[model samples]
Target: MGNTTEVTFFILAAYGDHGQIKYLYFSCLLLLYITICLANIILISLIYVDRSLHEPMYVFLCSLFMNELHGSTTFFSVLLLHILADTHEIAIAYCNVQSFFLHAYGTTEMYNLAVMAYDRYLSICHPLHYSSRMNSCKMYSLIVFTWSFAFFKFVIPMSLRLQLPLCGNIIDKLYCANYALVRLSCQNISLNNILGVFSLVLSVAVPLIPILFSYVNIVRICYKSPKEAQVKALNTCTPQVISLLYFSVSGFFEMVETQFDLTYVPQLIRNVCMVYLFACPQILNPVMYGVRLTKIRNAFKKRFFPNSTE
Candidate 1:
């Protein structure tokens, strides 16, 4: 226990000493960061400006896009900095902040998707009552609750880890993972691990309740509805369905990658698997909804290219 608390910085191991390839990494990373930022920003801006788009579904999409921006900046921006710097080392304070935001972002994202699913269900299943049920006030309240819940949820766990005396400062991933940070502690981490497991279950399962219930109802409703109604429901829910499935798959991989030993896999694949969770969703969600939702596509086109006839 000799000055275990003296650790000041942690080296990110996965970035390796790629030397000249760092420029390549920097370029690709810059492109991705910019793309995620610009796409999410434009979607949010469009939603804000176009009154026609001011509906429950679009409002939820705005919240979702905002989370995408939040998550992307939390990891990718910092990753770009490390990839370009001489050392892939992060200060202890900065590492802790990043870990907090990354974990919080995960929780926020899951609940955001859940809320979106619920919005879609109400729109399709209870169209008449949806207006009363998910009004602007209720919608904003839900958004605030999701963000606030996520913001504070990891505080205890982070505080628990901060109290531990760390004997090591090497984080294997390209970013500061909260659990990985906890693992570096030289002291007993039983409490941290137990709380981590409990938090994991709550973060993943709680949001899932609404998502599962909404989708099951949406599916059942469609099953009994007329063909035209079914097609309409399918069209309305396609973006949410795709987002939910993509999120679930990526989240599963992230869980496995973080919780299990996958040393047999190629380093590149493992690394890709780690970052894909953050990057893929931010990149795809805007593009998917913009194209799939005809109203959004038309609204954007009208805003930018009003003269063109469809």
Candidate 2:
């Protein structure tokens, strides 16, 4: 047999065949997609227009919102179309492309969060050196590194995946993931599995370990500092900690569901858990930042309702 596999399209099993409830599903998805767009766009605009908000933390926040937009758009734009179509199938080439972007999104978000954690650690734990440590040049370099690292990490595994002879053309999820695509391969995927595991570790562990370490130091410093300093640190870092917690929990559940037999669980519940992995971060990041961070909230107020005073 030739090394090349001939697969034309993929049917997504997660796309429910709800004859009467399809409209409801479409409406809900449309509403969600719109909300994500609006939140990210507004947050991005808030940062851009306000000159005071051009600092490193806000810059990272802006990047995070943009990543959320990219990730959601990658999944939902195709998803919304699939929802309306009679047959829920995606072309193989397009599926591969989507999988790459989505994986890029996941890795990029993790690195971005790790950067944010480092920023907070400097500001809170080493206030005196924070300015010199996270300067403009350094900040830009970190941002570039975040994107570059995520892109290269997936490119290798993705290229390897595309060469596999897929035994099946159906994915059991709403969207294409590298592993999901790899699981469909017919040939021995030992190499693919090894690469996949390595990719997952590099993507998740590399960024996450640093984040945890930063927070540990931050907490230790908070304990040693004065009451006022502790409060200030909490105020600035609470939203980020919350965002990290949400990502960790949601991501863990998704990974567990993927690895184990969750067939005993109701399809609706399982489906909700699966989509929440994608949806929660997009929704939670902006809202959590907007509400918890006083600067962003104030920026929004000043730009939109300058006349109001609390």
Candidate 3:
């Protein structure tokens, strides 16, 4: 209503204010970042180099690891910056870039999980056709589609945000999320909110529906098989299912926080959920897929320390 002055910068809330706690937080997050990078890198490398590990499942695992690396890097790197500077003033341009990457990676991760679920669906439901159905060309196409879909889903809302005039330069969360940014706009943001909800529904909720249905069918198929085979199937899928569940639920909670009141309790819970979303999957994924696989473990031992026989 006043002058149409555009806000140029936004302030972020630090997760913690106490100097000692902040220090502890930095130290802990740094350690986690290091672990996530190293573990995912090693897992991806092992899958790449080991001929025996070349399969549809391992390919999806590699993609997931890559997504995890990028996703965590986007958020945690900014957190590190905030901690070091002890301030939350971010330029509007930088905020847009951050928002773009965050949504891109988040959406990509969602699609990748969907791809992984479909792969499992093929493997369990149509065992004989799994190989031919998920061939290199098909896999590559799916990967491309995942990235493209994510890009469009994120870019559309981001483009809409660019048109709005920001009134205040203060974002409550540590990251430059779309809803968070939209709330600061002085213009009518009903369109942005509508698009945001639509994107969430399509990119997050829709993919999860198929994943759940696929898993249910997988479980049903496994139930009729021999106990040993069923156990093996469950073991192979348990990690991905658990990872998918955690990502989905935590993601929904974070989205809900954006729409509702942000009290201290919800904020604290959201922060904890964020750690689970960012840290836990990246940390556990490699261990579940690579380290637990005998072929990869043997390859690691053979390549790193040849003479030592375990």
- Using lDDT as the measure, which candidate wins? 1
RMSD for each model, in Å, please? 1.4, 1.8, 2.0
Ten contiguous residues with the weakest lDDT in model 1: 1-10
lDDT, candidate 2, equals 0.86
User: Compared with the true structure, what per-residue lDDT tens digits does model 3 show for residues 1-310?
Assistant: 4345568888887355656677787898899999999999988898889887788778887888998898889888788878767567888888888788888877888888889988989988899998899999999898889888888777778888888876777776777887888777777888888888898888878888878888999999998999998987787778778777777777777777778776766566667776776677778777776655667778788767799987
**Which stretch of 10 consecutive residues in model 2 shows the poorest summed lDDT?**
1-10
Number of clashes recorded per candidate: 0, 0, 0
Q: How accurate locally, in lDDT, is each candidate?
A: 0.88, 0.86, 0.81
lDDT of 3: 0.81
* Best-matching candidate per TM-score: 1
Better of 1 and 2 by lDDT: 1
Tens-place lDDT digits, model 1, residues 1-310: 4347578889998887778998997899789889999999999999999999999889889999999999899998678888888888899889999999989888998999899889989988898999899999999999999999998999899998888898888877888888888878787888998999989987999989999999999999999999999998898788887887887898888777777777788878878877788899999999999988988998999899999998
Task: Show pairs that collide, candidate 2.
Answer: none
Candidate 1 lDDT at 143 equals: 92
The TM-score obtained by model 1 is 0.96
Per-residue lDDT for 278 in model 2?
Answer: 79
Over 4 Å off in model 1, which ranges? 1-5
Runs with alpha carbons beyond 4 Å of true place in candidate 3: 1-5, 266-270, 305-310
